[model samples]
Structures are given as C-alpha cells and as structure tokens.
Target: MQTEKYRGYTLWGHAILQQEGIPQPAKFAGSGTVTRDTKVVEVSGVLDAFDSDEEAELVGLSWCRAWVDSHG
Candidate 1:
C-alpha cells in the first residue's frame, strides 16, 4: 500500500492486482505540491497474475474513485 498526504487529506493506495514486485507506470493527477502532506507512492507492480480477471490500473483508480466518492 501507498499513502500520499496532501494538506490535511491523506491518500492511501493499495495494489489489489499486483502480480510482480515492480509497479507499472501509472499517471496520477493530484492537486497541491509534494510536501510532508502531499506525495505519490507506487505500491506494487503489474504482472501476468492479473491477466486472469483483474485490471492493472483499476486498483489505483478504485482508490481514487473511493476518495472522490467519500469527499464528494
């Protein structure tokens, strides 16, 4: 899992479909600057294990989605 804190908000991410040890390149758009309260973290890698029924980027997207849902 990865945690990115921004201001007073904390963004926590988890690799639900991580198959490998290294995470794939993901494009993340967030507001604010990178500081003690704001940062980006890559949790895990994408591998063939997720080729069966899981999506690679969906894990991160889901976390973002949930964050939006909760905030909005």
Candidate 2:
C-alpha cells in the first residue's frame, strides 16, 4: 500500500496479489481510498487488473487523483 496527501485529502493506493488460479498478465488488482481529515471521502473497488504490483499501485493512485480533480 502507498499513501499521499493531495488537496487536503489523503489518498491510499494498493495492489492485490492475484491468486494462483487466476490467469496471467492481470497479476494484480488495483484499488484506492480517499479521505479528508481522517474522514472517508471516497473508496474504489477493484479499478482494474494490472500486469504488476507497481502498475496497479500507480493506477490506483492515479484514479484517486482524478477523482479529486473531477469532484473539485
């Protein structure tokens, strides 16, 4: 998991390891959360399947950033 502060909100990004039984390529699932002053603002379900943990984590963070921009 990774965390950052953006525009007075806290953003959390994570990568979920793919199970052994799952297909290849999409070896990680991306997700994220957004909070303001410890209060939950938004959370994302599995954003998408990614090729790597880093990719998933970045994607999740990007999603959260976009959310903040759009809602602003």
Task: Report every candidate's CA lDDT.
Answer: 0.39, 0.89
Model number with the top lDDT? 2
Question: What's the lDDT for candidate 2?
Answer: 0.89
**TM accuracy, model 2:** 0.86
Candidate 1 lDDT, 3-70, residue by residue in tens: 45443555444344333445764333222111223454332233223342224334544555455445
Give the least accurate 10-residue stretch of model 2, judged by summed lDDT: 18-27
* Sequence-dependent TM-score of model 1: 0.27
Q: Can you write out model 2's per-residue Cα lDDT over 1-72, one digit (the tens) per residue?
A: 888999988999999998867454458899999999899899899998887898888988999999999997
Report the Cα lDDT for residue 45, model 2: 94
What candidate 1 gets wrong by more than 4 Å, as runs, is: 18-72
